[model samples]
Target: MNSDRAAANDVDVDLGRLFGSLRRHWLGMLLFALISAALVFLLAAAATPKFRAETRVLIEQRETVFTRPQGEEAAVPAALDAEAIASQAEIMASAPILTKVARDFDLASLDEFDTSEPSFVEQFLTIIGMKADPIAVTPEEAVLASFREKLEIYRVENARVIVISFSSEDPRLAAAIPNAIADAYLENQRDARQQSNADATEWLEPEIADLRERVREVEERVARYRAESDLLIGQNNTVLATQQLSEISSELSRARAARAAAEADAQAARRALNGGGSLDTLPDVLESGLVERLRERQVDLQAQIADLSTTLLGNHPRIRALQSQLSDLDAQIGSEIRKIITGLETRAETARQREEDLTAEVNRLKAESARADEEQVELRALEREAAAQRELLESYLTRYREASARRDRDLLPVDARIFSRAIVPQEAYFPKVLPLTIAAFVAALLVGAIVLLLRELFSGRAMRPAYAHGETEAPSAASAKTGTAKPAAASPELPPAPRPLDMEPAAQVPTTPAGLTALDIEKAADRLVANGVTRALFISPEGDEAAAAAVLVAREIADTGLRVLLLDLTSTGAASRPMLETSSYAGITNILAAEAQFADIIHADLYSDCHVIPIGTADPARALSGIDRLPLIMNSLTTAYEIVLVECGVTDAAGIERLADDNTQIFVSLIDPEDEAIEETAEALKEEGFGSPVLVSPVGHEPETVPPGRTVA
Candidate 1:
């Protein structure tokens, strides 16, 4: 096993054989690599060095004052995103931009751009059918082609920056071309914008003029219609028809009130004159001077007559005179009352006449107002049309002024702007000389290495294992019957096996020519149980098939009510096979990384009593690097299960040695009967104190039935 440990450590590096191969072929391999590198370096130095220069442009959506509403800042389109910037880059590389750049630089006249005559070498190549002759083209086309070939326009990812790059043999030309392209693109955008505005102005001018005429015509029609209908406007912007109607109604009401008052006064005067009450109570009678004077005279006469009657006889002249005066005064007073009553009647009659006149005027106005109302409706409709036309004309005029002003002032807005100018390049962008040379050298060395390996393989000089004592010899056939057969010398370590005391000496389970049989699996399980081996790790010299065999044995052991757990420690999960697909947990990685609990990683439902912990999320190398905990994990698993079977896939002696203990049984599964390395591998394991190795070969026949007395439940 010390030899096995030595072999395992040397597994990663084939230093001895590699150095021997180098010793034999160093001069030839080094010469080949150096020559190849030197040739590549020379070619790189000879190639034309192209200087690349780039100019950055920013695409901004510009805003103009004319486009914005009053009292607000101008509203531009949304900011340019990556896609918009890319569009600007395409415009910079477009045919128009290239043509303008070419014209400005007079590129068509340069030999680099327009080579009219073919060189002698090119002519010879064309005649020999190795190359085609150059096609004839106009100077413009030639210039365009040459410009495009050197130009590269692209946008930065996820940004609004556009880069215009140009590659040329001359550094100054490369720098100058990118700047020129950027300038041309900006100029092109300005020209296009100005042209659009100019076109807009051209279209707007006539439309504004026509709208103005329409407005005038409609307004004139409204005026003429108003005059013909005689409809007028009044204070408060109200139509005269409505105003007149309102005034007439008010006047008629006032006139009726006056007439009624006059009638009431007249009736009161008549009642007073007829002796219904005192004439003084009547305002008309009291206001008369003649009536008042007559009353006073009557009072004086009555007093004088009373005095004369007392002083003289009834026939006295003085008494008769006072009596006559009193009679005259009374007649005058009565006449005055009659006159007051007659004046009241005349006032009432005048009021009635005035009311009749006002009523007739009111009725005439009402008819006129109704007629005017119908006419005003038509007049308002015409006015609205005229007003709409005037507004439209004003709007067009404003737009026309703006467009024309922009065209005249040449203040066109351009969205693309150059922000970074290209400078003269100090170095060539092409060739990448040093890197190319190094890569060529490495590639040549790799080829040499491959050749060396092939030679070693064909020459049969590859390293062979050296075993202790007679361990290198092949084991006899009888050893296979005992299940302790030493496998052929395949590796320095013999495959570890279970002790013979674990199994009864039963008839041999025949070996399959290629694959495993059920009898072989059962015998392995029986031996494990007999030896009280709760923890066993299985390995194979020739990998995959043995992993499958381990799975069969684990499943068979589990069916017998022995709690069996199959730990798929294989890198490829070949041991767990179809069972590995049922779970997502990492088998050894989970345990090593401590990412999953034991219960989380274990899937007990996979096979009747068999628990399987699959390889989990951690990478294989990371898991394997943390294998110091493997012993502890195995110990814990042994306590939980009656049989913990580990399918150790293609592991070295050191890996197996780490897990092997006094009570642990290790089985080496083999498929090929005549593998020459088995004996050596077996001897190495034996020396490592892993006990005699068991060689379980698959026989290509149906699995033997369970032993008569020991059928699995």
Candidate 2:
């Protein structure tokens, strides 16, 4: 790719090839330039002009400004919780917060906003009957929301600043949109805080009610349980036990009196007459004795009755049988004296055992009663403490409720201030029209460059300037000889001018298919009736200017002393050296317009009686302007000279047609090896409306045989 580019640059300065190509395609470039420039100009004029405006909003580091004595002052936050406050600026751009700004400002309508050519909008408005053309082309609704959409905010890189920007057709509106959005953001923040407070209050109402219900339910259950279980002091069972025991003691005294009467007379005959009366007609239960014996007998009977259980109850058959036996025995004895003696034995032991057991049972009952009372008192105290705690909690909960209810109605955000102002910037804040246009144009140029380059490459054109010049020039070696005379040297000072023609006709020319020698040129001239060539244009293949001049000089000696025109038909004019003899001469380029006239421009040195037209030093513009008319211009010059010779130097095929008319014989010149390729160039000319070429000027080291087959007429 780089080599190809270098090759293209090489084509630029080669005057011959450049002129040729210019001569060929001059009309194309003109057409291209005119057509392109027109289309571009119209496209530019048809575009709508857009205007822009802007505003900047700096995100503050803190809500409150801080002052310091020396270093930079830090901003103080209104929030005691500084971290939450610091996050506000970042949150301003976050979706949750910015989304709120969008919603509050009602930004949904801007989705179809058109910022293209503004002229289209005027027609659209006129059709809708909304406005008097351009003056009133505004949306009927959702304007604020649309404006918020146009607004954009960004934190500046590595700076404590945020840039708020907006775009619109109207510059004032562009600025207004951002300011309105910033206000919306600030207002939204305040309302968001209030909303948060309302939500918290809403939740606490239900929680407070539930806590109260739970506390009341527990208190009610405690009260019901205590009342059902008889939770009072002296009315319980242990306290009533003593009165029942006293009633049982009165019944025992009555039983003792009955037994004493039965024992008064016993069976007195049965008694041994010493100590007591013995029962005779009525026997006593205590036969030998008194009341003590009668009571023991009655207790023995009671003890037997005690052994009888509930299966018999009081009316059991065995108990009744025993009762009958006891009655008969009482009858048979007919004395209470025996029963009283039996009662005496039982009375003392039973009373002592009953008293001991009653004492122990009373002591146990008193101890249990005391412990139970103590437990009840402690439980009551705990219950009271818990109730007091619950009451205190209820008081706090009530306070919380009041605070929430009041705060919900009147709450305000503590740190609400403008984090950034509604700034209207002096510079553009709207569509950014100029910068956008410039960017579009630059992008267009880059794309166009790529397109042009690819087009040139894909066309398969040769791109190398070196190829255009054929090859780099190496200084040619002079034809060396064995016995050649030392050529006449010019004097140190300038030599005297010769007559009109000073050529040696007798110089040996070589005639070979390879090229002409000096003697051969002389013979050729002799055949043409002594210097017979009239006006002639001599041409050669690429890189053959030196050989072309050698042939033209040979022609100058032939055919009536020809006058010559040797055109340096290259872009860079590299073939001028061979045309110079003693001092330099004026050239064909000098005859061009805005330069010297044709007669004055053509130089005639004293080299020969024959005159020569040297190749020109004209650039493309100068050459094409007047040299384009060169043939018509040259008609006047035929009167001054008899024969003409032109050194048609190495050149491209661009202007070959100029030398191809009936008045001119195009002599194709070549060197030995590359001369074979000259046929192809001839074919190209033929295709461009040129016929057969008069072959000449094939140079070699020495005179050689002219090959018949190789020579073409």
Candidate 3:
């Protein structure tokens, strides 16, 4: 067991051994790296070097102030988006442009593009029917394929610039091809614009002539219709009759106003005469020259009477004569007013006659205007038709002029221009000898080191046994020398008891000893606690009842104030049933199957401080699917508890081998001390390099009563 613990402690990697392996094999590794770098250098030197050249074309509206159309000088041209730039790149690599470049360069005759004969490997494959004969193609097709392979066109990221690149064995040809492609693409755009202009000119010429004739005919028809209908436009673009009617209407309105004024004057004058009021009180009467003079005379006579009355008596001859004169003057003024009223009456009658004559003339003009309006509708229709034809003709003429100007001046410009011309490359683009050789050298050194390290590890020459503090190999040597094993001393809290295999050394034990020593549950538990065993794997060869020894021993250890866990790996719940509250509790199988976590599966033992995991409700087959995780589970349990007891029912040494580690103890539990299967199992475990199995019996330590809802099986 001490030897096994030393082997387990030595399992970690030793950096010193790895460094020693590298030191011893470094010369060979360096030589291998040198050879790899040399071969890479030679390959780089023998490979054909390719030179690449690039030309850039900027996609934009190329029209300058002078070349741009009228009224568009200040207009912003729509920018070419990413998709448009990509489309321009595709056009740069179009078949026509590529073919033109290929022909101009005579690419088909170049040795790089030669495809007349099949390769030696191809011929061999064809002869053996391993590969079918290749389909034949023309020289042009072969050249195009090779040219396309060498050419690369792509738009610069987030920009309206296209980069055209070509690779070739000849640096001059590489540079020239890209320049030629750019020139061809520009020329193609110009040709397309010119062709469009030419097409427009051809189509518009006849159409313009037809429109001019139609316009002339429509204008003549309008003129003839105007002459026949007598609907000539007069003032304000109105027909002649309509104009005359408007004039007559204006004159009639004035004449009626004059007549109303004259009648109003006559009526006002008559009302004054009848009401005994002075005629001068009326506006028209006051404005009249004769009436104004009469008013002044009356005012003078009143002043004179006022003065004479102040100085003369009424019976005086002189005063009477002056009064008589005043009477005569008043009578003269009255006669003049009567004459004015008669003139006003005559003027009003003359105004009435004039109003009647003007009204009759207006009625005659209205009839003429109505007839002319009817004719004007048809005339207006003819005029509209002529105007539409004339407008269309003008538009056609304008377009024709523009098209003719473009064709004559040859001012078409492409939207793209070559901004960068390709220059002959001075260096090859591929097979950088220095960098590649250095990389290969470094890579090979790493690979060689890795290979040597693997060899050292697999051969186990790098491993050296490790021992814990205050521990040594003296115990193993003493056991070998004495040929008898000493029993582990019991803990201070427990009584010393007989140990199972202390009577004979493990090496001298027979395959089927008839008088092998046996340990009751208490002594076995004390032995494990004393020896500080972290893991105890119980193999029950005598079936379910024998599994109880692992449970009892776990409980005994837990009672000593040491943490202990019993993991049931048995097919039945024999070992766990007495310690757990229920047989249906989740356990190791559930943990392996990932159905339950540790917190859910670990349960308190009913009668002891030990925790117990039952055989579990999960499917055993499913649990075995992840049985490779058993070691990890045991490691975790061992970390949390001082001792982890595993009851492996009816299993052999091989079955429990994965569960054991450096601090593990192996025990064969049985009801009978001399059971044949136990002896065979102990031999099997010994041959498998395990510590001699400790014999433990559960007969006297069985729990008197099982927990409720559980059976011991």
Candidate 4:
């Protein structure tokens, strides 16, 4: 408990001593700070102030009504993004726009922008070869360059609005430049649109005339084809030949039915005559009436013969006459039947002849219909082609009319409009004297603080009282404070090796005990180089005091032109407080978390070529998360720097395990040679493959002042 309290008191005393040093030199620090701030104020007052003016233009997707056909909407382009906005900015800042503005304003003659007349100072410097003479260029080019340099263009967030800014020594010129640029931009847009419309008209006129001639030609060709093919359309749009074929087919069918009926009648008549049946059944035989009469006469003759034969003898004259009449009647009936057969044959022959004539006509009409149908197919194809051409020609005429309207009216809508015009600024936008002066004061105060602190540190009187008093303590008293303060075993005597890499001799040690003095730090750097120890850890048995030793040693090594980095692993400002102080915690933990880049977090230290990475308020748990990456980080640092000195403070097994490698050098600070705590630490490091540790005496005492009873490693 007393040890913990004592450690806390030591921390308070360390902080108090630092503040006390600043307080003791307050007047000198204040004087230096005032002088620096005053110098900054004088320089700032001499600079010329520049006023800025801006104009806002809105860019949109739009087209004139005359350019588009009726019922057709204007095409909207794709949505604008960062690249499109930047493209617009480039256009506004282009040489053409700047040249136009310069020519109109006669900016070539202005003293502020004229490059032909170099300043007296520049001319003198050029003569001495300290500066180069201005390049010879046309006045137009010189003015354009000056105009572009002062011009600024940016887009409004989430909108298609462009803001053009111009800066100049004269407020009126600043205002005039942006407004002139905007007007020129609008003019360019108008001219571009007009040119496009004129081009459309130029191309469309010839095309429309060609289409009109083509329409007329196609119509005439269609009429000529119809006439030549003889494709006269009838009902249902059929050809006349096809209609004739249809009529002939119907008449032929009727004629065939009539012929069949006649043939059937003729066949019945012939059958009656050949079979010797009664002719009365045949229509032709009945119509004649001769057979009926013959039959009636025969019946009369038979009755007379029968009556006569009853009274008269055989071979009588009356009987003979009656018999002859009967025979004659039969002959007459046969004759009549023959005549009827002849008439039926004639009728059948007439029907067959009629059927043959109709069939021939139908066959001829069918051939004509086939020819007409084949021609009609070609005729329809031509008609379709003409129809399509007519449609296309009509469309072209419509578009041509719209283009003509646009060209004649000479009206074209600009895509952008000046929504806000620039006004003359009342005050300059740069070299704000008040804020700069205040900033200069703050900067100077920090610098003065650093100067005062460095002066106090070098004077050797700002160290803690313990550094001088503790050296006089007996071995028993030192042993109580440091648990391992017992005497150590002596090693074999060896000659001191020459310093490595031609290191300069170290300066004499200062009489201070806060940690290693400037001279001791230089010696440590020399020893580290001699041993070829690129990676080293400096720790105190108590942990808090070793940070200053590490920082000093790294700084001294950096002074020798070796790149060195001091890593402060302790959360307390032990390693970095003396050289730099920052509130934001960004270091290895940030690198491990991928939250920040190394360049963003790494800060330059007070000494030359020395960089320090403070443990900044990183969460201990988060920092520990990167424990496994410590070796990789150290290795990377070694490649970047000649030496990386880590202030491990009172070393933990976790800290040592992560940072230790085969060639690592371990240096420990000991207030007394026999401090038990430091000896135990050395033994632990050796067990962890660090080999034997190098012992460094605390500040305020030389190595020769140690008692003979004590052993130094």
| Tens-digit lDDT track of model 1 for 220-297 | 999899889988788788778778778878988988898899899998878766766777778877788887787788
CA lDDT of 73 in candidate 1?
Answer: 45
By lDDT, the best candidate is 3
Model 2 TM-score, 2 decimals: 0.32
Tell me the deviation in Å of residue 485 in model 4: 6.6
Name the Cα RMSD for model 4: 20.4
C-alpha TM-scores of all predictions: 0.53, 0.32, 0.55, 0.48
lDDT of 4 by residue, 413-518 (tens): 6767898999999999887887888898888888888865664444322332231133432122123234433322231132222212111222333233332232
Using TM-score, give the best candidate's number: 3
Clashes of each: 33, 90, 0, 8
Q: Rank the candidates by TM-score, best first.
A: 3, 1, 4, 2
Q: Provide the global lDDT of candidate 4 against the true structure.
A: 0.69
In order, the Cα lDDT scores of the candidates are: 0.70, 0.46, 0.76, 0.69
